[model samples]
Target chain A: MQHPVSEGVLQRPLEFTLDFFGVGEHHLRAMPLSSPTAVINAAAASTNRIKLSTAVTVLSTDDPIRVFQQLATASALAPGRIELVAGRGSSTITFPLFDYDERDYDMLYASKLALLMAVNTDESPTFDGPHRNRPLRDLTIVPRPEEPLKIWLGTGGSPNSVHRAAELGLPMFLGILGGTPEYWARYGHVYRDAWAQAGHPAEKADIAVAVHGFVAESGDRARATYLDYEHRMMADGAAELGRPVPARTDRAAALGAGGMVFVGDPNEIADRILHLHGLLGHTRQILQMDVGGMPQRDFLRGIELLGTKVLPQIRAELGTP
Target chain B: MQHPVSEGVLQRPLEFTLDFFGVGEHHLRAMPLSSPTAVINAAAASTNRIKLSTAVTVLSTDDPIRVFQQLATASALAPGRIELVAGRGSSTITFPLFDYDERDYDMLYASKLALLMAVNTDESPTFDGPHRNRPLRDLTIVPRPEEPLKIWLGTGGSPNSVHRAAELGLPMFLGILGGTPEYWARYGHVYRDAWAQAGHPAEKADIAVAVHGFVAESGDRARATYLDYEHRMMADGAAELGRPVPARTDRAAALGAGGMVFVGDPNEIADRILHLHGLLGHTRQILQMDVGGMPQRDFLRGIELLGTKVLPQIRAELGTP
Candidate 1:
């Protein structure tokens, strides 16, 4: 994978080698990795075992049929290894750029999500919605996957979004940028409760969490490195988007077990992950290690530590494969 | 490359090995290779030397910025090796499927083509057109290509399209499905005349030709093989699209030197290609060897002959690299 650290922003390749432990996904945030399907498809050509996905494919501004076709084509290259996480993007940049109105954000997301799911499951799907200029009657989105794509509803802590995912019987992916692990666990309960209310099986209600953090050889290095980069990332991102710089979180408090940021050595990080897993009962946890132009070596060392140190401890303690 | 013959329609990979001689492209017809950028990106991951392209991306129904981003992303995978051929598609399947009205076909193409060109050159572009829900004011399409993508104006012999390409200073890709070399040569003259009249340098007026063809060990074998599949393809496509089967062209006449089809042995095919080149002065010639349900072996053999025999002969005779 040609990492963004090598090519600069907006050209980052999603490194799916993390699929050895779990799936690796790239989200469309600000100006980076905007063409997630294209990057995943390119990565699909070379990697065999890794599962790749779009963490959040800004669904509101995109054509569902086009997204379905791109993912389906990528699946052809790497069968059974493609997944999609559709979200009303956290960033509103796409609405203006794609000629959509921000006022219709939720409405657009709901309409497009229905169409995306319909196209995934039906060979000839008929759908009518405000999102489309005209109703699609029995249109076949071509290059259907041999297996239907596994779609996750991505949300940034919206109760309505969680309920919609449950109602639709999709996996819920939580994008947790801030808040304590205990605080974030409430969304998982809400999702599962809604899933059951919607008459879905208990086993089917899956939840995944993504957080901003890093791991290093020592707790001191990890905390210091992550704090420096995370703060810079917030400021740089805000500046890039012409938004006000966000207030920085307390470094010591955030790195504590009560907070969401997961920076620490392998042992400490593993313990925190397990604690969060117990509270949320989530299916997966992804760490955003590289932020704010962090050097490749530091980011890679974090992944190495997560894989070689963190995962084994978590698996051993959980008594799972 | 995960050829569709190996998987099945709409799942075909655009084979780019032809770039040893020139670029390889896939066109979106009724249902085959519809997501060209995804396939190209996947192919780009494995191949180093082959130039990949969408011969005719149905630009009328697609968002130009999205198309640009997808192609730009693919270009990052294989820098300086991605090309886009934009056309008002020959098939009308996409319009209804994408919720586009066929009444605005030419208008949509012209508007989108302008935006595509604008984004390719300018980092921030402003535009207004009937095609857009709202006018774009200086929107920066993300991940601009390191090098501007080679955009070819694809036309199935439309005079207005030829003029547009010339006036825009873009290369013209003539999709010559059927026409005698002598007759098709007029388009080249027209394109060059307009290009020069529009004040573009003479050498920059490039013309590329794509035609239905097949090459076998013998002229009789090639003609019979291509005819059988071509007939089946035409009938199948018509039935699939619910259009009337097109009137069959005279087989002998089509296979003859004065005809467009280039079916024959390598020696005969080479001679015919040279004959066409003499008339058209085209920079690139791509043969559509696989049609209908032609076996993979036949397609591979045709490509093998084109690379090993036809290209070598043509290159030697032309005395140009």
Candidate 2:
């Protein structure tokens, strides 16, 4: 049983990013892990405190009942520590891969999210979604979690996604690829306002941020090291999506103060997190440290610095015990 | 990560039994495990040599693509050690729970099995099964295994199941709940004959057996301990199925030579296994030791005896290294 220190994940851990963005080839080359919930179950067996989630489950292409069942079983292994971050996926590859029509994306996500929420809340739920041939009439989903699982709506900051998440009273997990703290903060405010308007408690309208990042002994080293890997990832990813690759200068700009990428030294990364927290007021901020098949030594070092150096500084700044 | 020795599974392991036979209540009470492939992934993280499989993955109601993906991920965790035993589930509860008609059982299993086999063989399979709304035209499945997975057709000795398994050229996993060696051997021969008629190689026509069993220091003590639990399991299971409970006299008869339940001392269990092997010519035999909410201590001890005492005897009798 490897610890997050030995494996991955620092504090409030979110691991095993599942996506359809060149997932068949490039991502497979980048990481050995596959099938998020199953991987989390294995991680659940080893860890005691770190919250495990399927970073972003492509909920649009997956069966929500099976997802719930898998997560519920993982929760049994590590009770009260399992979570789910579902997304309608940024890539269109999954629809055809899973035999789903791309045209039904919105309907698919909406209906599946509804079913997932229903199954999460009730063991015996009757769902008549378009995905199913017949209505499930009070069918029991076994091995219910000890408590209701914390489900987050993972979004790339589309207005519909934010409003839908808020309306459903689900927490928001903002995935920031390239955007300033101020830019992301607007979505947070919109989500909270919509959540309150939808009659959900203000306290329950929680938010978390996910971003591309790395940390090293110095800011220059961190940025320099992450630059090539991030560029390669972007180039390969763009090619997969049949889009023009962004220039290295644009990638570098994303690592700047007004940018989204959070690469820097420990102190710099900590300050960046604090700044984001002040703007977004998010409870958690998880970094994608090992993007584009970065070396394990660098990735592990980044995680070590984040946990030991960066997180403590953020906690101190936030007045958290 | 817990080894099979520490957690469960003495030699060849089949942990995490997923069945909807009163699964919502009774089975949850009996086992902490749920969702076979997910649990197997957790087990895969720890063990290397001991093979892990989802003991009879209820295939009829499940999405074969998802199952393949999950199993393939586990294969990544423990390459060449992950296998799948897909069964058209004995219980009918999964059908309603997963939003499928029980009337479509034959069609569902047959079609899903076809898709699973195709995905196992080809990474980009074009499947147009009845279960799917549209055809998957050479859609690529990610993280292909280094080798094609060993898929066994799990059955309770139905003629149709036997023929289907043989016709598909899949290995047979005969599940013996209550049948004599001679009675079960007839199905093995039928399967082998069909395999030959189907033009499959004789060497590749492998068969494995599963039975309710326990091992103890003495034959009387083994039977005495297993009797109440097996009877209780049968009673609860029968009640779940809306069938009359088998009499204790009948269960006791099953523990005897001419019956299916293999319960006795190490020597007694070994002899029974050998006798059955001689009749059936199976490659492997797995026991359902912990049945009817049996105590962990007893189950653990049974596994210990099986690994240390019984397996050695079988090996010696078979003259294997």
Candidate 3:
């Protein structure tokens, strides 16, 4: 699946010290955004530093062995610089495509995740599960990376996903779209509680969230420009799902009232990011800006503004150098 | 599988136009050389321009979809600069590890190669081979590269391997590890005949060969040094196969009588390379020098000599830039 938009992003070089790098998902059928491993492999080559991440790589459909090996290969290029954000992704096309039942979602994810962890924990690995058609016996994943990878669970503020991450003692990445800052904050509490209940240390538990964001000369200017682009993408996405598009005007108003959409001047955008950091206490904050055929120059301008102004302001507010 | 020798080789930067690039096989358990794809991916990141290739990525045991995907991913980083030299590797470890029946070797390779070609040929492709457990419904391979990869069939001078390459209309890479240059030259003729018999044009047939070679200050010095290393490696290899090591004296004499091992001074090595090129009419010649824990500095020194001296001499004599 070759998506024109995917090529633009896959070819985008990480020119700065962006702590967490990520590629978005298009599920099984998205032409341009095929698998995250493909883009992440290219990302490994383009950037000397910065983590290789997936906003969400659907774990439910793909075989764990293949995913682990692929991620390990990407990480081998730059050990400790890759994170696989495993998720269901937004598209439902994978079930029929992979010959998987939709009802087996939880069991499949758990089984695959189990296999992945088993393979990683030993050089000569053996995995057998009902989900696997055949058992893998004494297999060694090649290109042994220098260190273990930090694979985060990507959740859409789903309770099960939050609890799964905590139960497994893995890091969590919350996709904070379509929600108020406080609305998603409850998941953070749930995740921490699950982690504590599961006997994992709070210090070791980590959370990261991604929210739609943009920065311009002024708050009004940023919102006005971003809203049109957001509405177009949302409408297209809704149509693809055979759902009626929610009224864009009402959606915009709701986002504006909640400060959920991080579209504003540098100061205002940074303030909301800080506000979320305070509300949810997320260890990392990723701003999803470029999407839905936004003009490359315009998207790049947003990136420049976000990096040069908003990021510095946020870092200063957080007392980080 | 991890071979200690490979790491030393993998770490070397391809600073010049040296012809046969490849990875040696160590099978599943060899701790050091796990798989060629892993090394090739690492090679992809480290080298620029010179073709990154696997000496033989075991095609029978690995998933064709995965192999194609891996190579495609590696090539996406350096489009048109990567070649996958698919081969039935020397190690027999993969058969049991991947649950492949030894009897199905030829059929497995054929079916997988067919699927790989099918996937490479179409954007949204579907393949349902009898050997494959399930039918694949129209699935698109990811990171569609800029150009179709030049996938060469690697053969150890086997007639079947040659016929398969010819029948498939693919280029052949002959791995001539032992025997005299003229002895190996016969396979080149066989391959050409097969290419013609298979209804492929003569001009379409291409061959490349790799041999054990070393470049030293002098012929006498090179032979004296190379023999000890060769004998040690040969003895270990024979032990692995439960066979007696060939007499070192006879082995040395056979190599000296013919232009097999190109271990000598730059002039001597260059002359032999040209001599074999004349005999086999091969378009490309690759020399593997490092073996049996040759000191990293010495191996690198051999590489330096081969590139700095032997290559320049060959190019000048060939009257090519």
Candidate that scores best on DockQ: 1
* Listed models, DockQ each: 0.51, 0.42, 0.20
Of 2 and 3, the candidate ranking higher by DockQ: 2
lDDT sort, best first:
1, 2, 3
Q: Which stretches of candidate 2 lie above 4 Å from their native place?
A: A1-33, A238-249, B1-32, B225-227, B237-249
Tell me the native contact fraction for each prediction.
Answer: 0.56, 0.49, 0.16
Per-residue lDDT of B1-321 in model 1, one digit per residue for the tens?
344322431222234135622223222334445687777777666566667788778899898888888888777777888899998987777888988999999999999999999889876778887778888874566676778999999999988999999999999998887778988888789999999999999998899898889888887977876887888887887777667988776677888988998999999999998999999899898888778878877777777778777888888999966
Which lDDT tens digits does candidate 3 get at residues B61-109?
7766666666766675566777787877665666755556877887888
lDDT of each candidate versus the true structure = 0.78, 0.76, 0.71
Per-chain TM-score of candidate 2, chain B:
0.90
True lDDT of residue A270, candidate 2: 90
Error of 3 at A212 (Å): 3.1
lDDT of 3 at A58: 80
Give a tens-digit lDDT track for model 2, residues A170-211. Answer: 989888887788988888899999999999989988998889
Docking class of 3: incorrect
Better of 2 and 3 by TM-score: 2
Q: Pick the candidate with the highest lDDT.
A: 1
Give TM-score values for chain A, per-prediction: 0.91, 0.90, 0.90
